[model samples]
Target: MQIGIIGAGGMAAYHAKGFTLAGAEVVGIADPNKPRSEAFAATHAIPATYRTLKEMKTQHPNLDAVSIVTPNKFHASLTIEALQMGLHVYCEKPPARNASEMQAMYDESKRAGKLLMFGFNNRMRPESRAIATYIEQGEVGRINSAQATWIRRAGIPGFGGWFTDKELAGGGPVIDLLHMIDLALYFMGYPEPNCVLASTFHDFMGNASFKGPWGIADGTGKMDVETACHAMVTFKSGQCLTIRNSWAEMNEREVVSTTFQGTKAGGKVERLFGIDGVDETSVDSAVLYTEEYGRQVNRTIITEKDETMGRIANAMNFVKCLMEGEKPANTPEEALILMRITDAIYKSSETGTCVML
Candidate 1:
């Protein structure tokens, strides 16, 4: 299994490491910035680098797949192009700018008879994997409602970069921190949503004090995206989901968590951070709330700590699905649905009314 990587940013390293760990050779890397691509390739021990995907493919004609780690604006176009070239694609998430783009990518993949998977990595977390098994075994029955949140006390990625520019990054934390939302939906069995009521606030849009510690290069682009978004989605099955996401808020600490209410039991998977994105300063836990012999009980579900937060594991799954016949952890269909819900959330926020799917 030979792979080509798109984008030479921080995430490309993770994909390179993951594919190599899964026994897939990363043959080449491509990025608009040649120096960055070369540096990344050299660091990862990749043999080649190119200025574009076309050039990479021309050089490595037998490349089996490509992992896209580009910005939100490039995900759909690149995925569609890669699939058209007869290569499987593993794209980083917020699937695309809108559902329409996601649908086009999905359609292209099907037309090309290739695989399309997104980086909804939360599904690969140890706690999430365990919770999924419990749900599958009927321990947590019929999830009725869920709340997904990724709130940071002062954790904006950058003050005025692509992340803060709505045109480039799609939206703020609602789209950027969508992992929790996807995780909640995955646990709910990916039900069809009926409608969404959402509101977005830009209170700290350009505040440098809220910048995150990741050190992504800051740009002088327009800082017009939201700082916080709150939304309620009701599903066709009558189940409900509430989403709360913010890069900057008046909170005590950074929290990434999802809690669900089920028929027989309830459960929560959470990570609390003293400083956002620093695993060493983070605490992880999973708990189940249920009754035994009519007595209320709580069970602490323990799992190994994953410092990478499943990012590498998610990439590995994509390779395994193609080379070892493993089922995909996430499908293009699920990604399209996630994007549709995301579109509705933004529309609802703009219209100040419920948006139907």
Candidate 2:
């Protein structure tokens, strides 16, 4: 299927890189910024470029799928448009800002009779996929409890950029932290989450410690929503999980780890340790631990590949699902559940009470 990407952002670049690696043709990219769009096209050698998504759709009626990599606010609208245009969509995570929007996207896809895949790429990551296998293999007897973190140190995203503006961003670390939340939910077999307790803060919005290269414009930074986020979430299948995430931090690394503690086997599926690096040298090392004969056994680190391995793997997964007329692992419905949990966490933090699902 000919893929037309709908953004010129870094995530767009990642998908293009992956698709190219997977031997998929990226014929066009629709971006508002001509320079950014041209830059992306030049970098990826795309044959066609348009000023907007609608224009791209009009020009490329034969396009089969679109990869939506726009900001949080545009996900649903762009996805709905693509579905209406008779194109399957593979959108990035936190599929929509809230359940209402997500459900609407799902409904549109259902009516269109097309596939809508959420870009939960970690579903195709090596260690993440392996750990899920381990759990099913009874390496972890029964995952009763789990704890994960996406905390950052000195990690405030572009201080005055869209990331700090809740209107543009939807939320702070909550959305950024959702990769872990979704992964943990996937690890837990995606049981129905029963309730959520959460706490959010704007305390670090003005903290200069978080201002590294991205200097704040004024004494007060433009920070809406929670700077630091924490959530206590429960699932109906007797599974409970704790999540910690922050984009505003003092140090530079992304997060600590996802410590998988279950009834039997346990490990960490991290970008560094557990995550097998399929990209260049920087991403190959991962944090992984396995328990064997009562001994905590750390497994051998995964190797890195030179190609657009990770993203292409994800693209192939989506293509295979589309070819077989089946939903990919990261379907819109599954992504909606994750987004709902994310929304509930934010709501719970605001009310300072447990939110019922």
Candidate 3:
């Protein structure tokens, strides 16, 4: 497979590496920043670089697919364009800025008969996949509710950049942490959200002391997005999902946890990442609790140590799907649902009322 990358940021580099590891030739890299594109191309040994997707398509006509690793606001337009140009797309998560854009992208993919997979690489984790399979096999029975959280003590990413800008990034942790949110929903079988009640806060907008693992803060740019968001989404299946995410918080440590309650058994997956960030194999575990043979049993499963490996697996799966005429596990339809829920979260937070899906 000949693949092209649509952005020259950290994620684009990571995806290019993954595609290369998956036996795909990264033919070109395109970014608005010419220097960044050139640097990424040089580092990856890609033969082509472009200042825009148009140039990339014009230059690399043989490219089989392209990964949209750009900002949230650009996802829809780029994805639609790629699909229209007869190219498959592996879009970065959060789908788009809102549901409407996501739907359009999805519709384009359907019309084009091309693959459109979201970059929810966490779901490709061994532990997460194991849990999902276990639940699907009826081990956990019918799920009732779930709590999904990814909170940090002081981890505002790329402060004053597009990450903190509402126009570019969409929202705060609500958009930023969509991977974890999608994981929770995936475990719940991608239930249709009936309504959402949410609250958002911007307590640490311009705080110079808090910085995450990416981007440099310039101190003069505005942080016009939320830093924290809490939302309760009720699904049509009567399953409730509670999501809590914050880039900056008054806490001791960063935590990633997802707990699910089901009719037959209950399970939880937890990971702790300190000041830097989480590693692939760092402090991750999944445990299930249930009664068997008149005895309580707790089964613990160890997740893969490195997230990068899972990303490689996901990239491989996407390439395999393209080669074998198989559909990807993370389809744009489910991504559309996720985006709808995300959009409702923002609306509900703004109105202080439940937003019906």
Candidate 1 C-alpha lDDT tens digits along 119-187: 888899999998999999999999999999999978889877889898889989989999999999999
Per-residue accuracy of model 3 over 1-357 as CA lDDT, tens digit each: 899899986677668777887678988888988898888889889998888888888887887899988878899999999999999999887789888998899889999999998788888877787788789899999989999998987788876788888888888888988777888888888998999999998897777676776554454455888888888999889999999999997876888878898899989877777457746435777899889999999999766566562677777778878776655779888988998998998889889999998
RMSD of each: 0.8, 3.8, 1.7
In candidate 3, stretches whose alpha carbon ends up further than 4 angstroms from where it belongs are 215-221, 278-281
Higher-scoring candidate on lDDT, 1 or 2: 1
Q: Is candidate 2 or candidate 3 better by lDDT?
A: 3
lDDT of 3 at 108: 94
Q: Which 10-residue window of candidate 3 scores lowest in summed lDDT?
A: 213-222
lDDT of 2 by residue, 1-357 (tens): 688999887678777866666556788999988988998899889998898778987888788888988878899999998899888888876688888899999999999998888777766666677667777787677677778787766666666676777776688888865777777878778888899999986767756666434342332335676778878988887789998887664434654456667766566766542222112333433444567788888775464432332555776666667665544777776777887888898889879899999
TM-score (C-alpha) between model 1 and the true structure: 0.99
Which order, best to worst by lDDT?
Answer: 1, 3, 2
In model 2, what lDDT does residue 220 have? 39
Worst 10 residues of 2 by lDDT: 273-282
In order, the Cα lDDT scores of the candidates are 0.92, 0.74, 0.84
Model 1 deviation from the true structure expressed as Cα RMSD, one decimal place: 0.8
Best by TM-score: 1
